[model samples]
Target: MNPLHRVGLATARHPWRTIAAWILVLVALGGLAATLGGELRDNWNVPDTRAQHGVDQLREHFPDAGGSSAQVVLHDDARLDAAVVDEVVAELEGSEHVTTVTPRLSEDGDTALLYVRYDVPTTDTDIYGIVDPLWEAAEPAEEAGYQVELGGELPGTATEIEGRGELIGILVALALLVIAFGSVVAAGLPIAVAVGGLVAGSSGVMLLAGLMDVSTSAPTIATMVGLGVGIDYALLIVTRHVARLRAGDTPVEAAARATATAGRSVVGAGLTVLVSLMGLRLAGLPTYDAFGFATAISVVCVMAAALTLVPALCALAGRRLMPRKVRRLDTSSPSGSDYSTTERGSSTTDDTWTARWVATVARKPVAWALVALTVLLALGAPALGMRTWPQDGGSDPKDSTTRAAYDLITDEFGPGANGPITLVADLDEVSPGEVEALHREVADLDEVASSTPVSTSPDGRLAVWDIEPTTSPIDEDTTVFLDELRADVLPDGVEATGYTPILGDISELLQERLWLVVGFVVLVSIVLLTVMFRSIVVPLKAAAMNLLSIAAAYGVLTLVFQHGWGSALLGVDHAIPVSSWVPILMFAVLFGLSMDYEVFLLSAVRDDWLDTGDAKGSVVRGIASTGRVISVAAAIMVAVFLGFATESAVVVKMLGVGLAVAVALDATVVRMILVPATMTLLGKWNWWLPGRSSAARQLDDELDVTPTPTH
Candidate 1:
């Protein structure tokens, strides 16, 4: 019996139950989405340690100092007049949100920059909400001849966040699916599955965020990744079912077999993906940890939908889903071949490349293993010097408006002009002498080019300072300096608060937690693989090989994107430090994707082995039978990732390229070449483990089905 036929039969046995459960799940997810309605903030809000400490220092040193302010650029040239400035300042001060307003002149003498200080911290969501009204109030200033432009990080980030990337991502996904699947209905199926998965995944992320301090970036990551993997997995199963139906199985039979075989493959693959993502929790960075957890949840949901909901839909659609003409086509043999002898018996019985490859492996397993091992080692060499840095502060791609603005700032001012570090401090019982001493200490620091004391709270509990660093804020050295200040400079007398300080602390914490995250992932991978294969040796081999492949991929990324060795050829500028999020994100995504091929290939091999009890023949036949489908699926996935690289964002580009490279490598080198060679080398040992005889027999019984001999 074909796997699709088995799937159809199984589904038929309890159609109502499957349908009812899916409907309930969908309804619950839909309700959650409706209620959440985009209310969640897009990124995590990490408070700034430096800014807090700076604020404290200022309050203790300069009691009369006002609060930190944002310089709003107004368009009207006439607002430069004293009368207009005075009127605008009075109105701003009168506003409930604005604590003080001071107008300053640009060197050009024609523009006025209003320094408006709000009573609340800049991270406060209410400050963002009030911006529109503030803009409205400033409109009269514009009417009086001033143009208003908000220029702070919070305002800029808020605006960008409002321009949600969801719609674009959806359109891209739909278009790709339609083109790849070549049917509106087929494309829609994957989209539907992805939507459900995304909704569920998003809800999971929200719940997690409510419990822990998670980066706002995690949800967007979950949505993007869930959709990509969901659609890819669905395409694999649906296409296989369609092929099976064309092979002359009835709709119900096709659904059953497809689900049983492809469904099983998906389950195994999904587990691999989930486990791989879970590995990211070992990264110890909150951003990566949250990302790993969120993505793992999404992958699980998507897998569930693909294995169950998809099969149910196929069962319901029956023959109607395939066009009448497609259903009528003969599919008893290979679609366009005339080798009668080759087509007879089980699909794996024929002499094929897989057979030839298996014969070679059997004859010279040692030689093949050596060759594969050498190639992997050589490829992974570049990873030794991998550098991790934030990709956010670099110049945007040349064509982007943000990049243009960034360039204007950098060229007119300097490299560090684009991103300034905010230093904040908490003030309690610190004396004025201590406060002044701290200020002078900061001013005299080698990295600190300049410092401006901004405000002192009326209660003298807080003060803020803006520090201009000699290097770009994103520079490693600058980050190091920030770390030193947080760890060594500040004592019980003052507390620092700001994004830079928080980032430094997080970086150090991530370094300490790195090994734990790695250990956790490896342990999980071992357990999951062991359970799935019921063979300790096989799981160990698979994990070792996967680690090698990942190392090679990272090496390539480091060489091209980090060291700037070939970035120009790849159409990117100077490489920034690989974002702190990249390793965990890449590990999870690559691991999951790699597992897709692993399960697909391994399942076929296991099936052939069960039927013939000839290990070599089974390995060859399995590889040959699934290789074409795996290649096509991998190609499509790579295309999707590569398309994402076209975006101007550097982090997104790195992610796209890295993932695409890993998938391609996994599909070809790892899956096709290394896996078979390594398994052949292991020989009978691949199934070595205590109690394995019974487990192997059980797996064989569960997966085994009567092969339909093509005559």
Candidate 2:
């Protein structure tokens, strides 16, 4: 017996024992997570970069300037009560986390702003928890008829958005499963297995989190990918088991065969996904590495469940997995009756629609291929102009305090007042006169809206200047201005170390390293596909197909999020630059997911080609066999991704929309249409590997005309 089948048989023979062991492990892991899980921090530690170097220098010489700062904005139609202003300032200055507080009054005295500096980085998980004191201090202002709104790191780190997105996604997926598989028992089994896998996977991530810097979003992202693939993998195995049983095999035999066939495909597909995800490590970014590890763990757990747990459940349910009426009909129907091969929970076995569709596509392979290629190119065109930046409070909800503070500041002062770029210099390494001269040059530049007087550290070894740009934080002009300062205006020893410049530096780093990451992902995928399909042409073609679909997804994001095309439909109020990390993360995830359909469809097609020695017929038959399951699985994934699109965070929405679009295009155009059309045109060349014999080529001429059973 095959290894996959042996595992399935052993689990099937002792379902209770297997299930009980899994439950015990889950409980133990959950307890460990509750007590020992480490805190997740958004530490953007991109090494070997100018931004990090500047940060290090600031921390060493000017700790006050290097620490994170929060803004407290107070506005009143009349002059702000002087005593109330002092009270808030005193409250902030009295906090243990606060290192310093500086107050600024607007020209009319109607608005007051306080810049409060903290000892820790704004992204530290500790910051979010210790903000209650500041909120308590602001209550006096609110009671005195003065509107108080907090901005900057204060509001950004205050509270993380909590949503029921995953739960809602699961509910939607279950509905689609019932519609596809008709039998409540059969549909429920996949859901149960998927949820179990998710629990195990999430627990593993928690255990790992206890030792490393996992982002708070890691669990949600892991859950998102795990649930969709878990259900889909289990569905494939269960679908195969039902077909084998209907063919008159005993329960144990049917489970074993299903595990051998679909189970193998599941393992192969899961491994491809894992390889693509693990390729993120090549980017040299810890954030991507954490993402790769968490998601990879989830994929492994689900694949394991599909091999063992799914088979165990199938054996226990036996023929009763179907509705009683449908079971009786399927068992009693004659050989020619439709019920002999399919009933409830097995509607996909009827390949009439898929077969006819493939036949139509085969007649005009060239035309269909060009049509899909053109659509993909058109959708991806906008990506040429895509811009990236860090999202700020300007994109926050209109009613939120952060947005209000940002608006008030922009209305009264310049837009750059919300995020002034700081200039830090070590005067001990250079003359104070030269530092002043550099400051004068910066203040005289055309891009300068205003500049604060240069201030020195307590020992006078360090000098700092806050320079406001003429444009907003997200404006391209701010980046251009920083470039000018670095190239010509600033002295050799002076450096820029503010949030705006640091963010700009990180963005540039990502842009520079983007190609390297892409190369790593494509190379890994090619090697994996070449070995799996046993054909050089198939791997190259798979790479091209995945790239095209991913390009199309990028175009969709550029149009919808960057160009404000249909932005209102997705809860976005205005156009904003794409997040810097979106492209790389999306590429890794989309490439892995795209390969899933490729592996499943080609695995079945290759099997048929070997058995029948007919290239064109095998192409058509392969699509007919796997099209329904792939379509259903893709639909479930799309729903899961789009559910996250409804989230409040802009970054999460971008990821959700991009993944949903990519999966949809891959399933319909790439898998159903392009793969068959291209294979038909390629003929025997599709399967050619090096050192093939003439006898193998000659066998393609002999066709097997026997019709394949739909199951």
Q: Which stretches of candidate 2 lie over 4 Å from their true place?
A: 330-349, 691-711
Clashes of each: 53, 0
Tell me the lDDT of model 1 at 263: 75
Worst 10 residues of 2 by lDDT: 701-710
lDDT (Cα, 0-100) at 582 in candidate 2: 81
Q: What is the lDDT of residue 639 in candidate 1?
A: 64
Local lDDT at 295 for model 2: 88
- Compute each candidate's TM-score over C-alphas: 0.78, 0.94
Q: Model 1: runs farther than 4 Å from truth?
A: 1-28, 36-38, 42-150, 159-216, 239-248, 278-297, 315-380, 391-393, 397-414, 417-431, 453-464, 483-496, 563-574, 690-711
Report how far off residue 271 is in candidate 1 (Å): 2.8
The digit string of per-residue lDDT tens for model 1 on 2-95 reads 5544555766456677768766876776576566534333333323434444544553554433233454555443326667666666766776
Q: Against the hidden true structure, what lDDT does model 1 obtain?
A: 0.63
Model 2 residue pairs with clashes: none
Per TM-score, the best of the predicted structures is: 2
